[model samples]
Target: MKRRDFFKKGTTAALAAGVVPIIASSCATSKAIIDDRKKDKWYHLGTGKKAIPERKITKDFEVAVIGGGAAGICAAVASARNGSKTVLVQDRPVLGGNASSEMRVHLNGVNSIKGKAERETGIIEELLLHNRFENEQESYPVFDHVMYDFVIREPNLTLMMNTQAVEAIMDGNKIKSAKCWQATTETLFTIRASIFIDCSGDGLLGASAGAEYRTGREGKAEFNETYAPDEPDGWQMGATLLMSSKDMGRPMQYSPPSYAIKYTHEDAHPRRSFKWFQDGIWWIEVGSKGDIIADAEVNRHKLMGYLHGVWDYIKNSGNFPEAENLALDWVGSLPSRRESRRFIGDYIVSEKDMTEHKHFNDAVAYGGWSLDEHNPGGIENISEPPSYFHYHFKKIYEFPFRSLYSKNVSNLMFAGRNVSQTHIALSSSRIMATCALMGQAVGTAATICNKKGVLPRDVAKNYILELQEQLIRDDAFIPNRPANDANDLTKSASLIFCSTTTSGDAKNLLNGISRDIDGNINHWQSDGLNAEVQLEWETAVEISTVELKCDTNVKRNIMMRKDSKNDELYGNHVPIEMLKSLSVHGRVNGKWQDLGTIEANRTRLIKFNFKPSKVTAVKLKLKDTYGAKNIKLFEVRCYA
Candidate 1:
């Protein structure tokens, strides 16, 4: 019988018996099995050939993003949106590093706990929204090709996959160019950019550029992080090759190759293991204490062998007679890495920041995952197995912008799991969702620096606020929203008075139109007036032009003070002369009102007021000229 068919049958039998296979190993194999068909090789899927070598090809870009992971993709999209000619380079054929379809790891984060969509802005969110709309709610194990298509299709983005950055061209403290190798042709290419971002999880660019960095833990007193150990330890979290299993019936004889399993609870310190099920799949996370990159292949083989051995025990051994049908299903292609190199940035996130919930001056992102540290060695001598687990930090913490830039390199920035942070801090912030936000911030900052003809360091010093504003405007959560300062009623009035509500029912409000009684209106309709209500005094106010969003496929009609005897309205209400659709910054002018172009689903509050001396009633009208239903209202407030 085929291995796959055998496993299927085994799974059916196990299920019928109501038994879950418990995998445990007590012996180690001596000889490594070499599988020629399954040998791991880095291939260039784009060009369909091996890497080629050639002379350096130099090209200048506004921003160069290294590493095509989640963070790198977000950064590239941000830079492009900010009008920077951006290039994205990756060592693999796919765009997503760990979360790629090839790798098959789901994007995980705390946002799911809060029932919030991923907190990233710009392209990442765009991709998620697209997937959500297209796939409905069945979009788990995301298609990696969609991610690749999204980045490659961007007009301002240049994507180079299967290209490995080999060296950094530096002049003084700034990186002038990045030297990359084309895997298919084995040719070299030189990419020059005004600003550079390091999204590589291993700090590859930082190391190549001679940037300062640290690996492993510091002494207890070094950063004053309470979790810092008293003695210096070399231990770090290990990597894992996740596998799944199903059940089959009938007894099967299986024997482990020698030296397949090693160590006992006595040999390993802090050895532990556990299991869980999610998304209708059984997951097994093994291997927590070896060098992730160096021992990737070895661990992969060991895991495969161990899984088969566990199946043999379940079928042939009496310990699991009820699990006679259990068998291995699929194993992960890439090792899920937990820790490696951490670059030194302008600011190092210490355990103190996490424990004390320290506020940052240039806060750009947030993280809520616990400080999860895995043991560093295999369970050779231990009586129990080693595992991965989290240590609670009690509160969520903010990550500062300074931690995203290289301390020693002026043009270099970093994001993803490799940002400037201590081992403990990285453990919590390394998740893909937080890294996506970091990528967006870096991309926006790089765009600003390129447009303004400045360095990344200058962005941190001078344009940090601008960068923060851009991120917040795009829906990323910055630590604090700058307070509205001016006291002028007209000038100070904002269409979107308060931030979008994050509570229930309001959760999907981003998907609909909403209005508050105070005249604050957020139009989520496809073909409706995108406007906000601002109150100037209790009743007296001016109706700012109703902004017509450009990207909207349909047209909308706007009428005001329907009951007023002397009411006036402006702009075209007809099909062609109607607002020619609006985008993020597009606006249309009406005789008595001005309409600004707004991105779809953006929060727009229409401002209006009742005259204390005029009448006792006020009315506003919005008619959807095209698509879906009429205007949607979120809240309505009355002022004294």
Candidate 2:
């Protein structure tokens, strides 16, 4: 039987039997054989235990994204949305990488900033808003489902979970195929694609394809980075084991395993806080002076040992009387990694690029997180502080496209911590939201490459402006570059408004500025609640698409969080500035007709696609905002 059919049958059997077959090895097939069931026992009919047969499956796509972390998820979604046939391969059973339930690291983004309009708006914001709407409980496992829904809903994307991409097939300098093993179904996937993105924190796909990369900190002289060591060494950031505990409302005793290590007051530093029993316990880390990728299993075991030791110290140590009723709820088996192999690209971002705010003509993304570098000794270095904050940007800085694609390997790109950067730059750009922006940028560049019949490097050189404009149209904010309105049909039409603006003019809608950049006001704020804006052309024009960019309250936080806090990042509420109900009308024959209507819009970018018609004018009526008192919008666009 074919491997696809075998997976179908296995899924059907799992549904009927109420149990899924556990994958023991990559060589094991999904086929089941039994004998002597009448004796109330089932036994294999084979003479002896044998390896399951290997099933080879070949497929093709325009783009293949490896690793389903925040970067991979955004890359695959953007690629598919941009009309590319895309495939996303993930080694774990669920998506979201460290942010998934298996690891439980909170998704961090521009929220680390104090007061500014630096929020990331594109696909990542869409996913966050969806989680707030669908996942009301704010559960981590449910957040996994939210990510799955986000990818599976895209028609041009194929998602393969529990599949590890092990090998890269090369044709000269370009990657021709990626070979993955799905142990759950005993299938070996040979995926052929035009472009490949390595969002895997380890950069395994790029490394296997002979892509030039760095594994350790570079010397200060290499990139002129002041934060680097005097001499280069193979010491990357350590991996962490996180745990969670809750108040049981009653006293509970804890038991320690035989292998658990012993911890004392002197073992950990006074700055390390274990009193809050939260999920993101980043201190239980181990690995340095060892190959993090090759020695992952060893580091995981060490992290677990240290984690159990810390728990024992909390429950058994006489110093903590407040832990009498607290009980451990969950302890992650997989270690959340901080750093690994970083791919080499045309331009490697350095500490000076962020600190000095270097300008790039090909800038595609922005990041503002502080330089947070953990100690090399991790938990072992108890005498020193856990982390060091080298620097923090006064405002967000631009990330260029040159550092996104590979320098040596053609048709190769990467995102997340594996992107081309000095160790100091990675410290700030490694945040999940920053990685998501890079993913969106690379995914968009891949689509342009597929459509234009060029490589990733060519997209950076020739089609850089097109790529930036497309990203802005999709609601991604570039630090200084405003949205281009040269080809927008609404730019030529005269605006007719039912209600005048109270603060800003209606012409600000087509001014091309979407967000507040460098203290510039770009959006149009109206006085009344049910205001209307219309654009009329001199002659009947054919219109097929209309895009409206609304306000999403980027200054506030809308992420789903487990802890209820007074801060903005932990608030799990929808943005009040978003448009909830609206209607679009078109004048075809001097009479306005209904074009489309949005009932419960939650995203910042609302796009409407309809059959092309000779419409003389298009009108947009705002019925109500999500909860805001008035109507506000950045831009209104029409396309032929």
Best by lDDT: 2
Off by over 4 Å in 1: 1-56, 112-122, 135-142, 246-274, 277-327, 378-390, 482-640
lDDT of 2 by residue, 338-378 (tens): 99888889999999999888889999999998888777667
Superposed Cα deviation of residue 582, candidate 1 (Å)? 12
- List pairs with backbone clashes in candidate 2: none
TM-score of each: 0.67, 0.90
TM-score between model 2 and native? 0.90
Residues 1-640 of candidate 1 have per-residue lDDT tens digits of 2111111101111111101111111111111111122334547889897653333467888899998888999999888878999999988777777667445555554432232222333455455544433443232244456677778888999998877665677899998888776655444678998888988787666677887777666667888766666755555555555544455465444465563342222332343432222111112233322244444445555554444444454445565455555555554555666677778888899877876778887898877666765434432212333433446644457899999998888888999887888877877788786788899999999988877888877888888778876675454655434312122222322233312222223212232222111223333322335432222234343332222121111112111111111212211222222222232211112123322332233222323332322212222233332343333333232322
